[model samples]
Target: MQAAEWRESIRNKKILVLGLAKTGVSVVKHLQALGAIVTVNDFKPLDENKEAQSLIDENNARVVAGSHPVSLLDEDFAFMVKNPGIPYTNPMVVRALEIGLPVYTDVELADKMTDATIIGITGSNGKTTTTSLVGEMLSHASNLEGQSFVGGNIGIPSLDIASQASEADRLILELSSFQLMGASEFKPHIAAITNIYGAHLDYHGSMEEYISAKWRITANQTSEDYLILNADQKSVFGERQTNATIVPFSSTSQQIDGAWYDQATEKFMWHEEVVLDRRDLLLPGNHNVENMLVTMAVGKLLGVSNEDIKAGLAQFHGVKHRLQFVAEIDGRRFYNDSKATNNDATITALDSFMGPNDRVVWLAGGLDRGNTIDELGAHMDKVHAMVLSGESAEKFQALGQAKGITAIAKAEWIEDAVQKALDLSNEGDIILLSPASASWDQYPNFENRGDRYIKAIEALANPDSL
Candidate 1:
């Protein structure tokens, strides 16, 4: 729909926005501009929330703060615009659903405002890297009808991008299961599920629910659209049906009709043509090779040239906090894989850095989600020393001791962990921050934790600091 028609449809409609963050504030601004009567709600007190105060003072928004009172339902809201992170079981949300009021996330709203061809990517991991790679590949394509715009869970709000996006643009979105769960009419022209694994059980309450939420990305797709499925995890999905054409990508098998890595040639095969050689990639890990398979599928479908795809891969060096290389101090190299918030991700990080003789001073631990360290059992051999922190520090310490790691120490938090890790490292050792748990216990998010780690490393590397 055009902006005018969208505005007309929502004009004068009473909408309730749940949870106040940057995205929540954006939702309020857009709705208010469209003449919608928006009631902004957040758990933070009004005095403590600068966003709420500004909304009230600047836009005259109906600000409800300090709680998510179910009583707000008395206002007879037409529907709810919810922050993706807020669970559906929240009292207000549960009550709203009980009354049959429609609830949607800003991603749905963003979809309705733009005519751009959307490439939505989601997975248990590799979402950011694959989305970013596709964006770079398409950006290098000189013949594309549209420019590439990347957003969603990767950082920028989709609404902000959708508002400015034209028909001659492709919005490459990195979606989370949380964001996908709330998206109803948000179908992309091409959708990709990189892979699925057990994750976010706290939010979804179960692995089945988490997988279901991720599967929603393909729910609205038709034969006219394309769906990229990770061939390795085909068994997990088990003959699920979707109207969209399935483009299977694999790192271990040769796909005659889709995208795959040809083990014999050491090349990424896109429908029989070699798009890229694995050795040419700057990013490490087999997980990244899997990511590139998805990217190759998306690039091929979008008509990106092989040369441009190769160029994109050559220049890109992975995203921040996901196996990103920091400065080298003395002979020890530091890597920030702060985005590795789960065991599978951390295992991938460990596998990426493992070599014949390289020892890793592994800095890990964070919010305890009750995940088992069983998967890391075999990989623990590479950990020369372990500096743990956060809520999961004790759990990790126990695991380290169980694995017979001689150098196991706990720190108060990430900064302290970094210092202890530096002290434990040898001249040739790799200092890695690949926390196997979420950062919420000590930091607001993984990005803050990663920034702190980077800052600590930089501070230690300064010559004048001594």
Candidate 2:
């Protein structure tokens, strides 16, 4: 459908809002503000509804809680404003599309509302960290008028922020697969696809479809835009289908043209002129070093000075939920890495901090994405014991059994997993939650999973015993 036709059809029309989550609530508010009759739908009961009620009552949108049936949809509604978490292949969504109901996403709405320069970051992993770092770096370098806020897949509603963000001369956006699917014309001045690995396989159906979604960051880029990529990841840098000037960064080699790693001082050498020291990066990881290189290359492309880049790198405190330290007790360090939902991320988390002799009780498992956990075989020797939970618990147990290692893989819940981990942990040991699977099986998202893990660890490690 043409953009104008799509817009007019939804203009002041009845709309069905699916998934009353953060993004869903924001979409309801935006659509209602434009005088559309909105009805919020979810799989839970509406009675005593807390978050949904506040958003619905304020916007005068009706709430149909407790299961999503096609009957809940009013024929008068022109389109379905889908939450990114909901699959495009969902029976309800597919049926809606079949009936000529236009399915629009939050990104599509945000794209229509903003006129500011956008920098969207997408990948199978590292989107949140990279987006946050980019925003921080821009803040240090940019003397431009207006404000800059980072949001999209990371957190917050960019459209809502854009409407109120006067000081935002630029917006740093973290786009996800669902957000990118309906982004339509969402392009960024500086776009990067950090890395692609097997992820959200259930939602994507195939690896090819998943890769296509990540590339959506560069979907609408013109000749004037910058497309920075992880030179280490062939899934991104090796793609010859793109039109933007391919700037690459890698920790492995300095052979890439634009940004390459210096093995001596561990600095990111760019254009044979600028260098950003890896030591200056606050986030401690070889993965983060790669993340920093990508951001600095983008900064260099924008003519951001060395001092500003350094200042930005220093000020960046690192993203929460990715190896975020919760607390330590009895000399045991507990880390909440609920964000490590893929194989690469979990492996990076283990390699970043685990010591050779440290009794590492690794908490893993969740819905199996058909990912090859064999990739984690190298770190398997590093980890002392594995505590498995969620759908893939047995698979992990089998892996440990086959390898003849110590592991506990019977947890039905996060707390069970924590207790199992604690039972296996000793003084000077580290407890890490680096589940290599999506969190949707047991929690709202990875943040919820991480928060629960941190809370459970806090209860286990009582310092008042001091």
Candidate 3:
């Protein structure tokens, strides 16, 4: 029986959830009803996550909330559901794998639990925008089961409900290299890579390691499967062999196949066949153009009609925290780009930094993962001034000032960073929070960082201050 069936069964079972993150909480909620006793563990202290406290209390499950202990897995339950964020080398998880207990992510659970035809999207950047676009493009994608869930990596474990999904329709998954690295017996019928760039070197420990993980999207496909590749990715643009039929998309060059950029009109040429006005895309930046092409190709391959694709793209709103606009505060616009955790993403954030009056007070820096900033150097002049924070703050400040790009270093906090950006920003200036590093130093993750930035900006905007 699948998770849904097991939950309703009278037989009690033991299951260990290896992380108490957001997805873990959702999985716990569902498993509790299935008569499975779940023990939730994490690297943070038991009381660290206040939001999770109420959940732990309600679920009545044992909590090993700080630093996963190998002892927790001591010959434990039938299986373990690993969170995507956890690394492969984790000692506790490694021990579980050695014991021959099945270990998998919420994605694998979702895949096994549901009969939905999965369309998995992964790449170094642009995944969130592309995933949301594809999900919006074909809301009608439904499995014979008559239901579908669209999520993964971008937040929400869409696969958690797979076992009980009625429609189990088409699933549009936003996959990450980290998530793909640990997967086994997991394959998407339709897979796409928006583009790949230097990112997550710390986790993978090398660009080669990173690229190897990205390629897993198409590793297990059969000839009937569809593989969408971004022709613009120099690392993976050319010379590819896969069992799946290949579909390519790009915004930089026009060549042989699936999707190409029409430089003249700034629109996407589908199948190198039809053109859609680029300006009509709701998302901004050259990066987004590349992402939309992937979505268009996948959408059409999945049997979505041209009209349905148009409807989805036209109605699609960009994902939150990826250049999400809050509002104008004190004549300065605020943007929450906490999703721009690495240099490649921040470059995309900066690409969209050009303001109406050529003014941008950039808020950059965080737990620098060691990805080089040589690429962003060319856009220095576009940033009028930078308000820096986090461990990488000083380094970026030095780089900015050295390049003669006006810069300032501030205490490592979003409030201080926002205030400093505002102090230096003039009317028509954009108060941008596009930190180029991970937010783990002061926040749980990017979402927490994005939330704090939004809250701080709101408080400051309405302050009765001096």
Better of 1 and 2 by TM-score: 1
RMSD of candidate 3 to true structure, Å: 6.1
In candidate 3, list every pair of residues with a backbone clash.
7-34, 43-67, 142-169, 143-169, 145-166, 145-167, 146-167, 147-167, 147-168, 147-169
State, as a TM-score between 0 and 1, how close model 3 is to the true structure.
0.71
Better of 1 and 3 by TM-score: 1
Model 1: residue 12 alpha-carbon error in angstroms: 3.0
52-124 in candidate 1: lDDT tens per residue? 9999999999998998889889887889988999998899888988898889988888878788898999999
Better of 1 and 2 by lDDT: 1
Off by over 4 Å in 2: 1-13, 48-51, 65-78, 99-101, 235-240, 325-346, 353-466
Q: After superposition, how far is residue 189 of candidate 2 from its true place, in Å?
A: 2.6
- Pairs of colliding residues, candidate 1: none
Per-model TM-score, in order, reads 0.80, 0.71, 0.71
Order of the predicted models by TM-score, top scorer first: 1, 3, 2
* Range of the 10 consecutive residues with the lowest summed lDDT in candidate 2: 1-10
TM-score, model 1 to reference: 0.80
In model 2, what are the clashing residue pairs, if there are any? 44-66, 146-167, 146-168, 147-167, 147-168
Q: Across residues 334-430, which tens digit of lDDT does each residue of candidate 2 receive? A: 7788888898788888787643465678888998887678778677766768888888888778777766776565788898888888788788888
The residue-level lDDT of candidate 2 at 58 comes to 67
